[model samples]
Target: SQLSFINVQNRGNFRWPYDGLYQDEDGTLSGVVGGIVLSPDGLWSTSTTCTQTPNFLNAKTCPSSVGRWVRYAFNNANLAPNGEALFIYDTSNHYTIVLNLKKRLTHPDGYMMDLLTRQSYLFQFNGANSSVNLSYTGVVYDLVPGDYLIIRHNIDYIPDRVYTTSSSILAASSNTPLTAT
Candidate 1:
């Protein structure tokens, strides 16, 4: 079978597959913006919607005031030595995706042992600015051959207000391969 990489662009008010799956009740899926689906070959894709809930009535909806990030797994064997993932946010009208290496890092105290490495990328879909390209980069960690890569997108709302967002992990390479490993 051919490796299928699912790509979803400009997800706002429309209901589409994001970050793996979608839930109508939890308005916080995929970080309130754009999301991604992956292929077996380590290729990534994204999507957007224009749907908003009653809680977000006062706030903006998809393709309007939201963006997202996706998480995928990376295998050391499949990547070049010190490989990097190049991320580009398609800012065709007023939309853009920003890349943030580490916006926030914290621990709950005793429960935490090793520091968690967080790499985040943001997608800004701004229709008013008319900007074209927004891009960023992330370095591949020293992962084992059987480990997975987690990819996510960060989004900025237009009004710059804090709201609740949600997301989920659909499928990982650890469970199933797009093709036989």
Candidate 2:
């Protein structure tokens, strides 16, 4: 069986884990084109560069002015038998982010299943500094003899002032335990 996950969140004042800068078509030093940032301790950070091409079918183009794309990933380890992981961080300031999921399944008989799922999470960084840590749990299911699963991640970052609500999704295949680690 295959599995995937994606998380989109408003990341304010957070630096990219690496040093390279992202550029746009005009050659300007763009932030990020929607990619995942992993910390030294294996924690996930929401930092992405906006891109012109819509990677995910459900992703909508950000208005010309806000050229920010969502940042997240589909980790293969999350698909191992009884596999489990966490996705989270803190937004030191009040911000919002959108998380989406896309799954594809293929059967030996040429049958396929494609599905899209999404949720939003609002982070209010009440700390004195402009930093926050958000996290989530992930789990995968076992394959029934001939079954196959494919998981993808879709993320979108929206400015905090645009919306005031947030959402989240909790899914499980078998009875896998989800913890913050």
Candidate 3:
């Protein structure tokens, strides 16, 4: 899908099939903001751009105020090599999936690993921002050969969500082809 949104309510996982996924706005759920990629065991990542805030609300357990809030720019600069990207839960303690930019053969779809359960989930969006529309397949699919672009909007509302859309000349490559998905 070109653009999609999946509501993550009462859940700690999120996934975007073929695009960059991000939080809807600068809005925070229970005082948490932005998203981050985690290791398979929900421990660490190679990315140095992500910021961690202690004592942040755990959207999974909001109102109770438990867990840390991780922040990262949903752009190429903060792009992860290959891992699940997570955003702060919404006001109702759910997550919503949004669009993002670029994808690679090695890194095709996005996956979410529950920190508490460590259960991996594969998800897709219905392009609607409603809670009932989203669903998980309970299976991870193989990567398809195509030029998929996951474009996360350069949202500046949240200080941590600020990202640049500009591309670096040295990093820019004309070899990558954009295949219609």
Best by TM-score: 1
RMSD of each: 18.6, 19.5, 19.1
Model 1 CA deviation exceeding 4 Å by range: 1-22, 25-49, 57-69, 72-87, 91-94, 101-181
| Tens-place lDDT digits, model 3, residues 1-181 | 1222356443233232322222312324223333332221222222134333223222121211222322222222233343233442322333444343335323344332222211222223333232232222222222233312232222223332222233322333343332333
Flag the better candidate by lDDT, 1 or 2: 1
Cα lDDT tens digits for candidate 1, 1-181:
1222245333333221111223323334334333222111111212334332222212223332232322322222122233333233232322223222221123111010110123222222223221222232223323344433233334232222222212333332232212213
As a whole number from 0 to 100, the lDDT of residue 47 in candidate 1 is: 30
Each candidate structure's TM-score, on Cα atoms with residue i matched to residue i, is: 0.20, 0.17, 0.18
Q: Best-fitting candidate, measured by lDDT?
A: 3
Clashes of 3: 14
Q: What is the lDDT of residue 67 in candidate 1?
A: 26
Q: What number of clashing residue pairs does each candidate have, in the order they appear?
A: 55, 23, 14
- Residue-level error in angstroms, candidate 3, position 86: 11
Worst 10 residues of 1 by lDDT: 107-116
lDDT of 2 by residue, 60-93 (tens): 2222343222233322322323322222323232
